[model samples]
Target: MSSASSSSVSAAAPASDWSAARIAEAAAEIVAGEQLPAIVQAGHPVLRTRAVAFDGQLDAELLDALLTIMRRTMHEAPGVGLAAPQIGLPLRLAVLEDTWAADEEIAHTRSREPLPFVAMVNPAYIPVGDGRAEFFEGCLSVRGYTAVVRRPDRVEARWSAPDGAARAAEFRGWQARIVQHETDHLGGTLYLDKAEARSLCANEEYSARWAQSTPEHAARALGF
Candidate 1:
């Protein structure tokens, strides 16, 4: 979600109701019902609400399992990141990994690179420079749509790991976008709210027309 907030945003009790053991129970129910845990889609109450801060709400066992499941879910979705709210747990937790690069040229153009899996809790970020960049982005929650969203080109990010270890790192380019996208979920923000409306398109159209190393051409054509 974007930093732009509206009156529709709500708080805990709704999405944050699941955490610790509650999350496990929810997943178990999904499995028991012969369904895999699903991504909470747009318009759901869970996606419209802010995630709760992670402050010892889960025991070590629950935390580990939750992180594992989240990572697996993200990988299975084959997405670079997955936030807690996307999976019905509105806690400040998310997993991220991006190992794909079509080729060296695209990688360098977007500053894209392989990022190992990491589970961030209560994550936050601040722009590292005045630099900004724009590119098409898609969300697992939003499903088959993509849009151009401008974001800080670099950032100083801080979050606690699943192991309770604190981390502060500098991220730039595509990785910075990934961090911001996931962190926005904790605040009940979606990239849609911040995206250039004119650039919105179905995933198919995105691939059929605007799939490029950068968004400059699309931005010009879409009048965004």
Candidate 2:
């Protein structure tokens, strides 16, 4: 089968309350068939441009469609999070998977663990606690490169949920980093902007060093 057909089949097969027919219809409207999104490459103007604020109500069909697209795109690309702009949609919204859970088998194996899906709309973050951690970062838009970026080990974020409920929540460790990274994308800032000079690396180099560095040391090395 063609890659596009294969992707369509995969996306269609996810078992969720979200209807397959609805997903297929919405996907057709927002995405171009099964083609991979034209991820805004590093130098693209849109990648650097701050997205316009989303002024409409959150519970609309469009928001639902966007959420689906974000989920599918992130899943297809295997990233922990994605911002609307990365897929050429200009909206102040992003999605992040809780990476901490993904990294630890004990966490993932727990029955009550929250699903990895999270969506933030018009979100803002406040760093909580003075501790910081550094971790290797990669972007779907800037495929094949990785960087070390430092971020607060925890943060307090406020945003409206997809259902229009206001939320204030604390996130720590890798979850904190993922939220901050995806939030920056909504604001049109790539990790490269916040990345420390020495921490930047091609994928292979990053893989080599990521295993050796302490979290704190990695954060500092990445200029976080």
Total backbone clashes of candidate 1, pairs 3 or more residues apart or in separate chains: 4
What lDDT tens digits, residue by residue, belong to model 1 across residues 160-186? Answer: 888889999999888888898888888
Candidate 2 lDDT over 1-224, as tens digits, reads 00000000112122223233443443355654456675677777656665555566333776876688777777777766778768666566788764332334423322113336778877878788798765566788887887667778778888878877888888776667776777777665777776776766677765565544343555556555
Root-mean-square deviation of candidate 2: 10.6
* lDDT (CA) per prediction: 0.77, 0.62
Per-residue lDDT, model 2, residue 160, is 77
Pick out the ten consecutive residues of candidate 1 with the lowest summed lDDT: 1-10
Q: Which stretches of candidate 2 lie over 4 Å from their true place?
A: 1-36, 57-59, 99-115, 213-224
